[model samples]
Target: MPHDQTTGIPPLKHALTRLLLILAIIAALPAAAESAGKPEAAPDIDIRTAQREFRLSSLRGNVIYLDFWASWCTPCRESFPWMNRMEQKYSARGFKIIAINLDEDRSRAEVFLKKYPARFTIGFDAAGKSAEIFDVRGMPSSYLIDRQGKLITRHIGFRQKDTAGLESAIRSALNRQESK
Candidate 1:
């Protein structure tokens, strides 16, 4: 093994490390390209929940609220009850709330679920592939998707004051879907 005298490390080892990094970036491209910001089609999510496998495309004709959350996030804990209410209130009207948990440890998410049960669909994404596709930038990021699967709006954090506006957006999307 030829040593790089300047760094005192083998040249072959450094080249292999760089090659691995490049390969990882290349592998991530397809997932990043899957979804973008608002006014575009929502990314397809094929994630497994404890109950069952969830697919975003399966609910194509319904207005969707896609939320990215983690078990340890306080705002995420606050949002669950509100989301449950929304799901119960609007599910019959072709509205669906799909909350994806991004906790790296599945056990933590399970514990959270035990404390605050979700009425709507809950999907686990321990690897964060779905979150990456959605370009989630915060602990609790929410995206509203119209019936046609287009991303309508996004909310970054959960606050009691924000509920009314978020509900309004959900209602508006549902209404718009009804009209069309």
Candidate 2:
């Protein structure tokens, strides 16, 4: 094997080193492309509830409505019934709603849930860590994630009149195909 006079490294070893560097750069291209303009992946949610622990990744391949709420938020109260209806209407079509409560007091959330009655999955984040992960800026923020785990849209608040528009977004997501 010929040695490189400059650093005493073997020519074959130097060639292999350059090849590895090229391979590493090629391996990073896809990740760079994904980060450049592609839709961002929804942040994972690992939260606990009274019934069981919930993970956002478990519902991959389903369009997800990830909502962050608190007990004192009046708009959250209004959104629960609509979310329940959406869950019922879309579950069979590969849609799931995971609403995470940001209330520090679990009892407050329990009382609120008793009144609102969520049919969708409920996650309790008493420490508000999930809210921070989602960058929740308001009480009733919601994110619509496509089936491929990309975030499609975010709604900051809920209103009765927004029902049709929100449902339309969900339907569009349900109908959308994964980007090639």
Candidate 3:
């Protein structure tokens, strides 16, 4: 009996503690696995743009600043001007910003655009095919893609504070294009 409970803890307490620990560990798993690593190619996006057909595969030779946006997403609105500036600043250096609108209704996207216009290629993904391929878990998700179509960086959410970091990554990706 002395060795049976030498630690001074009861069996029920020990079991509950172990169970809670396991549950806590289980809760941490999804957070730990959130990263979508570099993919060989971004999802094949063939969507309608205001001007013409927009295809991700067609832009294979340029650094692509791909962003998933929704009309209701406030951060998506904030991202537009920053992305527009980026497009103007870097387009001459072979960079392209492709903002994929994911509003369920095209009219919502149109309305949103009337408020926050993007200067780059704005495409429609009403069916969410590209967002599915990218495993998007949040609004305004974005990815930096290299000239060879490799997904270089995946960002889940956007903040106004995130602009500089995002721009730096884009600059790094654009610079890589010069060497190749």
Candidate 4:
């Protein structure tokens, strides 16, 4: 094994350095392939709302507020009214809110619905397959999907104060589509 005496680094150390460089390059590939600040195409999940078959892909031309919520999440209630206002404000302009309930039991979600009762579409995903696709990190995770079906941004949790930012993103997304 030839060693670099001047540098005091052995041949094995050189090999390890090369291995580390390869690992680092491999680790960065996925993030590199992903376009920075570009919205990802959402998974078109087969889901049923209380009143309709909510085909996610059918909303290509419309801005989407795709939210994941569970009945037990308290912040979810706070998001409902804001979503309602948003829907009312933007629905005519080709915007819609789709709240996916990740409750294990539909009855619990139904009960919560009776209380917070959203004016927007509510879809049920008892198996949480949709959540897995979205890579939801929190109880009330949300994705702001643009009119072209690309994700604009995501919100991890909800609060009354979060509405301003959320609304701004929504407006920006809506207007961005209108121009195109």
The TM-score leader among the candidates is 4
- Candidate 1 per-residue lDDT, tens place, 1-180, comes to 689889877998888989999999999888777653337878887968777896888889999899999988999989999999999999999998889999899899989999999998889998899999999999799999998889889889999999999999999988877887
lDDT of 4 by residue, 50-119 (tens): 7778578888899999999999999998889889999999999999999999999999999999998799
**Model 3 bad stretches (over 4 Å):** 1-39
Ten residues in sequence with the least summed lDDT for candidate 4: 33-42
Question: Which pairs clash (backbone N, Cα, C closer than 3 Å) in model 4?
Answer: none
- In order of lDDT, best first, we have 1, 4, 2, 3
Worst 10 residues of 1 by lDDT: 30-39
Off by over 4 Å in 4: 1-34
Q: How close is every model to the real structure, measured as TM-score?
A: 0.77, 0.76, 0.76, 0.80
Scored against the true structure, residue 152 in model 3 reaches a CA lDDT of 87
Residues 8-97 of candidate 3: C-alpha lDDT, one tens digit per residue: 767777778889999999998886666444345677768678779966888888999888999999888788888899999999999998
Quickly count the clashes in candidate 3. Answer: 0
lDDT of each: 0.90, 0.89, 0.85, 0.89
Clashes of each: 0, 0, 0, 0
Best by lDDT: 1
104 in model 3: Cα distance from truth in Å?
1.4
Candidate 2 vs candidate 3: the lDDT winner is 2
**Cα RMSD for candidate 2?**
9.5
